[model samples]
Target: MMRFFTGLITVTLLLGGVGTVWLFLTPSGTNLRYLMADTLITTQHRSWAKYIIGQHAMETRVQAYQQQFNEMGEERDTHEIHPDSVPAQAPAAGTNHEAETALTEKKPLVEIEEISGHGYSGYVMTVNDPTKIRIGVPEKKGRGERVLSMAERTGAIAGVNGGGFADPNWQGNGFQPIGIVMSGGELFYDDLGKSKSTQVVGLDDNGKMVAGRYSLDELKALGVKEAVTFQPRIIVNGKGLIKDAADGWGIAPRTAMGQREDGAILFVVIDGRQPGHSIGANLYDVQQIMLEHGAVIAANLDGGSSTVLVKDGQVLNKPSTKSSEGRYLPSAFLVFEHPELAEIQNVWAGLKPGDIDPGKW
Candidate 1:
């Protein structure tokens, strides 16, 4: 019934020449109501029928896009776009694929495949080798989130807000957060609570490296105190304090400990060799691989369907390829313009620590 009425309205509106006005005037989410409210009057030209028919066409368009949004699940709930969504405000010059990757010799990762979809834009700071990547998560956070929390920044398997695992905020009307990063060695961890030096250095749309709260000491304490390993191994600091901790995103929180052979401690996320996730890195597999990579301390980030990497402008590893469920994350470490580091610092000056809110899966 809905489909039949919608089609009729669309044809009538297109013929009436009011489609443009109707589309522009009609706000998102109001289309469905407009369609179901009124009846058609074929002979009534320039009247309510035109308005009604226009609304129907717009409603149909919205539903079509809804399906597309579902395909890009992460964006389903993020209906209202930020100013940054439009093409008017382009990213910094070098942040784009060509400019960012022009220095192929300097940044190999930026020149490879690109995956600039996930509410982010990146630059390859120093892709010395594929194994060692230094990603930077820029400052563009979600609309409702106050600030990107530690859980989000670390790419946890669950959202910190109300989705995924469920929270009272969204009223259980959300999906699970499934996000992760891949590395070969255990990375150091710390807390940025008290210290001010070891701050967050990321970008703002204008190509700048902004500062963040917490010093190296603080980060070291909060990020990594212990380490563990999983497939595609690396080291991650383990010590994210969740007062009401339920799941450590994916892996056990304690596993993110130990050092590596090269002494480059990075985090690693491993997963079970299941059918859809046949290539994933898991704990058991992580231990074996990290041991080979000389990983002494290793911990898993969000893995399984969450495993992801962006080289050039493409998603390096399959990010939830098998699962329509995108990786639910609270935060991430994307790479952007280090040249604008000073600019980023300026933005940081006006900010406080822990300003970004965590999202629900």
Candidate 2:
């Protein structure tokens, strides 16, 4: 009996040692290790990633990603869109006669289609009229608002979350935006000084999708109507930036915006972290999706737990939050029937970066 027990223990130990060596020494295992670390960096438990990849290596990886994103923004985007060619309505469901009649009638303001690839699944929302898209903010004074609430308050047809903020320990109030926010062709918030520049994703006066790095003067010259600070324009001039899935920052929920040649705005909301339903996508996956959908220009938006889609005052996608509603965000891209009528007041009007407390609820 003792010999049998010893033999079993010896076999188990041998197997465990082999598994440990394979996990640490193999290329595929290393890729997975870094991937896990990258995903942790996006969450509140960022420090835990050190166990997988050392603290120094993790910091180096993050800095490298930041540099890459900054360089991507530096490349000029010279794409243009003409909204006149875009079909104003969805095609009728069944017959040719109905389709002919529907062509003349006003089409649905937004069209949503389910998209899936590899290990991820999400929705793509196309706003037929790019001109009717605006950045909606929170109604109250202090805290940030959910995308659903913003859509409901503005009576918008659809919306997706926008930009990143000061989320101290991932429990930020969502009131303070990182760089800049522009709404209704007005400068709502600006932290970048006169000479500095930031990567921005927004629309110009002609409803052209404007993205990439630009200073205050450049944004003004382009007549950007609705803008928010974000990073890494993934596609520009009809070319994908990230080379492959391995280079895609990490596998996590993603939100991205793109513009077709016909001037329709595309919003991609990918869900992640859920085991069987979705594992999420990387930037390369997002870029490919945009290119497949005829995007001439595309930019990454604030994602992860903040990824959400709202239509007709109802949450359309399953948000990966404890409440399933999504995180409080400072800005959202909302589609309105009469976007000019949306009353989005600047909540950060008089506050400075130092003045706001992101940790305060």
Candidate 3:
């Protein structure tokens, strides 16, 4: 009995030592500490994990990391001309002739290509005209809708998850979006008071991809057709915004959107968390992918478990969540055959923010 006990203890010690070594020596860009922290907080003993790692410390670290990357500066000439810089021009009273002509011309509406690099492999969806893109919101105010469901309901040929949602305790109802959600030129959700100057990703009436900081009124003035708000614009003007992998928002599953100079929208989704299959990708990897594909303007969308790409009623990428299908989200950018024909009703029309509880499913 004594001998057996000694052998068991020795084996346990050896395994623990090996695991610790692997975690530390894996790679320079790997976020082993974050992985451990996330795992602990997500498990049933979250209180214990918080006590061990100090929630405040973890949050401070995360903020510091994000701040470092955000301050790295944008690539020059990649951003749209400031609204104030443009001379005032008469607003067209009806349909834009130029936009209509561009839409009617023969061009590939959507194309998907496989993209790969040193540490990542994913797909880049090229949208010829940004006008065909539309934001799909959930029908119910307090409940979320799946991206696939939104795509099917809207008759979209392709769809990708959009924006961030209020995920309380990581078990949110997924009904509430964290920032603004504008579809069909109408504001459905706004949290500008809580967070000033959100980074918006959308399109103007002329099919121009609009990305940058904007207020609700500014969005209105810009004639934004479809928009959703999120953070940390990764590329501006054909240059990568993130400086390095360590500051690349802690490597994980990623979903980002960008636009080329030719008015083509780029959608990228990198699968993650499945160790042997796809560990994940950092913001730098995503930035590099965007640059290689000729993206002049690019920004990160709600990634992690919300990352998804669907085409023709089929999921294109492997979602990192246990659900496999992907999480129910508040919004998704759907591609339509006739975007002008899409009739999207405001789900949050009569409801106030207080009416919804993110903790409730």
Candidate 4:
């Protein structure tokens, strides 16, 4: 009997070792490693995971691997557009005759298309007029609202997830935005130090998509009508800011906003964390897609479970969350026929940060 037990234990140990080796050898396992590393770095001030793996070393290794794969130049099921295919000159900053001409030319006001790449599939929505876009804020101060609810309430034709929010233990109410939230040219939330700059994604008064680091005064001076704070601008001046996939904030569900040379807004949503469908997409993949679609400027939005797309009062993309709709959010970019007429109240008025506790929800 002792011999039998010893044999079983040995078999179990061998199987465990084999399983570990097999997992590391698989593409999914590679993706999992990067994803875990990214989450650890972003969510924590100082991560033990980074200490265990050596943050710099892990990043270097990932970048090298990605670079090697890119050098291969092998084409798989990728829908990427070659850099040369895009026009040499993008539209000038702010609205101009070129932008007007592009708008007058033939193109649907809103176009939704399926986008697929080497390892993932997703959707992109293109909006011709940037002025039609506006931010939808919840009515109450300390709570959150779903994108669908905000869309229906505001009579929006389409909506997509907006800024990042506070989520304690990944269980917060999503009521508090990390930084500022500006709607209709009004500053609704500001948590940064005075004169400090934060990366914002929004539209200026000229109806052009504006994304970059800016202070509140700078944003106001630029005539930013709608804005949300989020990080790591992926593209600037028709150039991909991210070097490679390794630097591309690890693969997961993603939401990004961009503008074409013609001033068309691009909303991208990629589903992740669901195997057998779409594993996920990195910032590198997103940059390529935006370039292929003619985006000269782009920035990442709040992704993960908050990544979602809704059109015509229906959820368009499959959100990577247990909730079929999506996690409640603080804001959403809602599209309307006459945005100037849409009424969005200032919900956070008269409330201070200390009054809110996201974890309670």
Best by lDDT: 2
- Specify the poorest-scoring 10-residue window by lDDT in model 1: 72-81
Query: Is candidate 1 or 3 superior in lDDT?
Result: 3
The lDDT values for all models are 0.29, 0.89, 0.77, 0.78
Model 3, 168-239: lDDT tens digits are 777787898987999988888887785646677788887777777777777787788888987678887667
Identify the leading candidate in terms of TM-score.
Answer: 2
Q: Rank by TM-score, highest first.
A: 2, 3, 4, 1
What is the Å distance of residue 130 in model 2 from its true position? Answer: 0.6
- Of 1 and 4, the candidate ahead on TM-score is 4
Model 1, 183-285: lDDT tens per residue? 1112222222343442132222222112223234433444421111122112222211212111111121111222323223223322222334332322343
For candidate 2, the TM-score is: 0.94
Better of 3 and 4 by TM-score: 3
Off by over 4 Å in 4: 1-36, 39-106
Question: Candidate 4 residues 1-361, lDDT tens each?
Answer: 9999999999999999987776567777666666667645443232544653467856675567445433322221112223223343455568789786785565556789998776678899988777799999887767889898899998999989999888887778888888889999988888886657777888887677777777788788878899998755777777777787766766778899998765678999898777888878888899889988878788889888898899888888788778889988999999998998899998888887788888875
Per-candidate clashes, comma-separated: 101, 1, 2, 0
Model 2, span 1-361: residue lDDT tens = 9999999999999999998887799998899999889888877788988999899999999999999999999888888787666655666567597677867786577999999999899999998778999998888767899999899888898999999888988888898888889999998888776648999999998899999999988999999999999988999999999999889988889999999998889999999989899999999999999999999999999999899999887887778899678999899999999987888898878776677787898
Q: Estimate each model's TM-score.
A: 0.31, 0.94, 0.79, 0.78
